[model samples]
Target: MNKFYTAQEVADKLKIKKTTVYELIKRGELSSSKIGKQLRVSEDQLSLYLNGAAKNSVSAQHHDYQPESSLLKRDYLLHSSGLIISGQASPALDLLLNQLPSTPGNLPVLQSHMNTYNGLYSLYFEKVHIACAAAAPEDVRSLVPGLSLTALLFCQYPMGFYVKKGNPRNIHDFPDLTRADIIFANREKGSSRRVLLDRTLKSSGISPESISGYRNELVSDYSTAAAVAGGQADVALGESYAVRSFPELTFLPLTQETLYLIMHSENLDTPGFQAVTETISSENFRRTLALQTGYDTTHTGEIFSI
Candidate 1:
């Protein structure tokens, strides 16, 4: 008979923690054999697994991992109580909280922001169950090794120059922002608005130094919109919904972008997480989001798993 290695031994060989190894077994993420009361993997089976890993078996691929119910029951212990959902400041997060079932009749929902990068790191630390971010397809690819991104919606919002509510500057599009007379406002680093501004400038072929008052950066979309509203800057890039509540600014339609919900893939099977996914697709929720803003919610809560 061939000698067999326990899960802990296999974990040591793989250089991962024993807890992760047990998690893999509980999740059915690793293969093994049951010999009476013992669970083990033969040396040959281990070598075969290593060889298959080199070739990247369909099931072994990072994107192909699926946790069965048996695994969920063993690993995910639900207490059926409160959970903290941390993300950026947005009405959508509020909408999600409102839709979740309050089992004890009333349980508070905690919301916070670490920006997108820090938010992803927070999730990796198990500090939050859900994280929200305006991630481009490329950003999604970069963030996926640690977080599994689910496409919540492609918000086709009017993202562009937030000018004073009038035809004073004649700022119609990206090019006009470079006019010698126009003073442009920008967003701070690690913000979604900042990323959009940089990309828009590159796409429009405008030199950063060429624009007047380019260094003037605001912290959030609300602040960016307010800068234009307060006449601090003639123009600034922002979303329509940000300034729609404020009558002082005008929003010009810009590019359509994707908004993603990033979370540990293990959260997908949790009851609270499942509730979030269900709420995003509900007809009532869709109607509320549509009525409040001109956001396109046609495919809200849709999953584009990679």
Candidate 2:
């Protein structure tokens, strides 16, 4: 049987600090399981992370990656001009992709799970055709620097703090997070949610360091919500619709953000883009998304400039 090690145990074995171990787990780099509200890394998981650490280093992923060059392209994307979207997995997008012509290959056809910065990065290099982002107006505009971007209003949903049932911490506002009682679950950097949280924190004049567990990150809305639900965290940011299925969590609405499907203006005239637009505009698509995801899809298919 694989032995489960505490965060401190894992940290000692790797010759790193306990906080660093939590940071690794927060980044989703080190696999761990929650043991009655405490995180533990199995022996096998630690070995797997150590094995992949060399090839998937931070330097290579964050700084050295070159998506524009032919040498470093994602082979699964197929066809230089093919439609590849980057964002959280969506069944609606899947159905739309199924309508497109398939490139016969052994590789699986899938959307890259990169959102915000990384998604826009892929788009900037033409590695991806579309990117889904939810953020403030100004921040969204800064995604693509040189390229003129055309955005299609996708969905509007409530973005807020996810707290445990009854919100025992009574985390009603941003200032409440500063209290020593609340253990926050933050989203990873570069994610649109994290960007929103950071900008909000700045504007609200709430120092991130003041919040307990503010540095304890989780990779996705669901994961963050799950942490709160599992009692691993006191508060986490997420979309109202995304965390709806996570039981034992109360979503305190802070603001609503419109998610947009953004792409380069140069590809606006392409047949692939045209099909994508058409699919989004269909009554069924808009209605289905609203009903299933609880997103405001009234303007889902409308085009706009960012």
Candidate 3:
């Protein structure tokens, strides 16, 4: 369906008057178009406007020193905020960092525990401009409508068991986790890995409770890796990047998962967003990803739009 909202529709959605919406459009705070003398907005654009407005206001209040650029550069790359990578897609972020020119100036990049669903929520709230997620095709199709997306070929990473150092118990496959002595460190819900694991177990006629140590959960793949490294658990299921981070553990390849670049469509043409896309698609970037331990770069930068 076409995404078009009238001034009255916007006013009703935001609990304001039609005149107020008109004023916003006049001041260029909201995006609209002329359709036979009537103004209209994209449903996605309105959601972004409302979300960005609230977030920018709170941010301005906290800083106590809001600059003129904050109010003026809403449509441009005038602001630089730290990029968050959820659950350790280090190779992709590394490629992004290398491609960004340092001679111009340095930019901030911070890693956080933002899984698939949570990362999308952050994008909706305007908390972060870009996020790395291992979301499935079906999940993307279910998101709140009206939003636009641009997916970059991140990496083809394998989903597998992270066994303790030296593979002491000789754990070979998913079925091995059901052993009485094997301690499994699980990832929380909302993570793509968790969804894959749940579906696999269900298809295999295995109740989650049948697996040992199902009661405990880790917030991220890194934490799960840490749990295995610390002898707290015998195995953890996560992506290839997690195994690369902790060399002491043995990685068992199970399945291949594609990691993608996620961002609001409005920001698609922004310099920063374009830089992110170009960086991911470059030959140097692909080589770097290929060199990174345990990642397959064959499908990097492929687009799978919802």
Candidate 4:
């Protein structure tokens, strides 16, 4: 007799949200049955899926990733899992991916994450070879903690608030969040924007609970910025380049944030790693990157030990 488990049970056993369980089923990654409009998974099917996933998992903590692995691991150099690059998907990054040499036959691919925090965490766990983040090295090291990774300077961009045109609410700084009339749409927890918000709120001695819409979370910069553009939100934290797509919204510069390519210190000298440095440091890369609004290429390919 096969025991059938509800979506919630599968989510619990897998340590994921219930919505994700149903999504997996929808994607045919996980098998399920509809017991009169209720989704159910059999133990055998779930077991099979877990076993297969573990064998393919780069790190169980991050999922839905392509099978490719790091730049050049000594153990699997021949059957190497290609280099995995993690970060928010951006034009510059996509260009970097295209410029990368077809190492082991064009195996490099970007493992898109929500933002810098997710990318940095993936770097810390050795899940990705090179990770990008819109976070300064010191900020990532001190405030977020965990990684002993090296930082490769990618570019610099302004970090700021996304507000409606003409700054209707007179929303100028982080303190504006404390105003009773302000409605905030926030980035997901752990994103650099979210990190900055939390850090600033704490330093200002303002209790998070005191702010209205403080708990309201938006999934990505695009979404959060869109909320402000559509008048659904009063303000959102974002890096300047990202909010450029929403022309209707106005960006109020707060500070500058540097984009960094993070990696394990031990992998610095690898040939594949060198290829990455070459691609980013090249004149063509910088020239095109500088063309993008709000990007500073002064230190585009510089590396630093973090």
Candidate 5:
């Protein structure tokens, strides 16, 4: 005889909410059968779903596809010039990329959102034209040994904990993450925010094992915030921009970091590169950044220290 699991049982096994399980069923991603108005998943189906998910997660972690080769076909490449941008994801960055095609030169810009380290690595290998980072220049320089890189100051924003509304857990700083009762959500290993959080915890003499859900990793800031918002996590480290999307969550400011647009020194003279820099420095772009919350545009396009 085959065993069947209810939606709640599946949620418990997967460490997610029953509602999320129902949503998966509604979307037809999870195989389910209705039995007396209750949805149930068979043991074999559950195993199949989990195995497929694990395989996909492993695949995503192992490969970092180049933008032009992946998104642009041979026919499209013949008629258009490609400019690949890889780095941290932000609303400001999205807005700027969206406006690139309308710029005077009209180059086709493709965004490959990854962590700061991977972004820098891609830039070093000429895989991307621009790499955005939140780390300091000194740290970024250490990553690319033989290449001459230039960094342009993009914007500054507050980074901190995203917690439930009304200060429920009172999670204000890094140390609070170790509390016995708190469950934390973490970003992937290469993310800048995760790097800062781990360093702070190490200096404070806190073991990652002491924190519940320390091994639970999500891909993006919005997803991290959503996990917390959906009651799957107690707190997560992210920037102020993610808070705007989750009204049920509030941001506790911990520190501020500057965002920079990095590029190879040789690419500085290219028309595509020039177009990006010009668009970022334009009055219209500045106005757009100014209107966005949690971002400081005073030095939006300033070339800080190359």
Candidate 6:
């Protein structure tokens, strides 16, 4: 005799909400049989669905994804037996994910590195479970118009200029990048660092076009620093943590920024979501953050409504 699982049992096995399981069944992704007005999924059907979903996910990762295409990829992951975490990359968040205690279904956490704005957009659209962002509170509030969100302070870190070890250019402030001799490795548009750089340049009466390599875009803080260390640019704005990885570079503190984790209001009560929060609040995770350079975890795990 073959065993069958109820919708709720499938949810427990997949570590997802019962509603999500029903959505899968409704979409014809998961085959179900009805017996005496109750729906049940055969074990073999569950195995087939999981295998097909895995194959689709692997194929999607290799595609050249546009913004809309990326959203579709995120949706697929959200429906799979994994928690999708999208946002700015942080060692702290990575550590938290590694330390989270195993739950009933043991869902894996998938990290998606994206800019602050994109991360928030994913969360707003229900494409991701958690969004790690480093933008100002006001900016984040504007992204999710209709969705209710809960934001938590992940950590505070200093942002600054990553220059060559000797500081040959003597670049001291934001305006220095406007000097004819300087070449800047800039973050891509929509990134928090890029937004800050533009704002700072505007307030200082500096035209970005006047700065050499102003349009030279790099994706992450590490890549931005790598440009400078590799002698491709003079300076780049990035978090201090990046400096630790590139010994050939030196850091000059610019400003401190807070990184937050934003989630939908409804997910806070879910078992997986609660496990994530518990991990964030654990003493072990706190200790790990304390040991990491350039991070201040004093406010880690504190939730606020935005």
Estimate the TM-score of every prediction. 0.66, 0.71, 0.65, 0.72, 0.73, 0.74
Give the per-residue lDDT digits (tens) of candidate 2, residues 125-207.
66566887775556666756777889887778888989877877878888887888778889888787888878878999998
lDDT of 1 by residue, 156-219 (tens): 4556668888848988877787789999888766667777777778987888888887788765
Prediction 5 global C-alpha lDDT? 0.75
The lDDT-based order of candidates, best leading, equals: 6, 5, 4, 2, 3, 1
Give lDDT tens digits, candidate 3, residues 104-197: 3333443333567666655554545666777765565465246677666688877888987779999987788899998899987777878888
For candidate 5, the clash count comes to: 0
Where does candidate 5 have its weakest 10-residue lDDT segment?
Answer: 71-80
Candidate number with greatest lDDT: 6
Top candidate by TM-score: 6
Off by over 4 Å in 2: 1-81, 90-109
Tens-digit per-residue lDDT, 26-136, candidate 4: 433554543433456777667756865775675556664543434211221222235656665566776677667543324434243436765565555554567788776
Model with the higher TM-score, candidate 4 or 5 = 5
| Candidate 3 overall lDDT versus native | 0.68
Residues 97-185 of candidate 6: C-alpha lDDT, one tens digit per residue: 66764434234554555677777876676666788888887888898777778887788889999998889899999879888888999
Better structure of 5 and 6 per lDDT: 6
Segments of candidate 6 deviating more than 4 angstroms: 1-78, 102-106
Query: How does model 1 fare in lDDT?
Result: 0.64
Model 3 TM-score is: 0.65
**Cα distance off (Å), candidate 5, residue 119:** 0.7
lDDT of 4: 0.71
Q: How much lDDT does each candidate structure score?
A: 0.64, 0.71, 0.68, 0.71, 0.75, 0.77
Candidate 3 residue runs with Cα over 4 Å from true position: 1-89, 102-113, 245-248
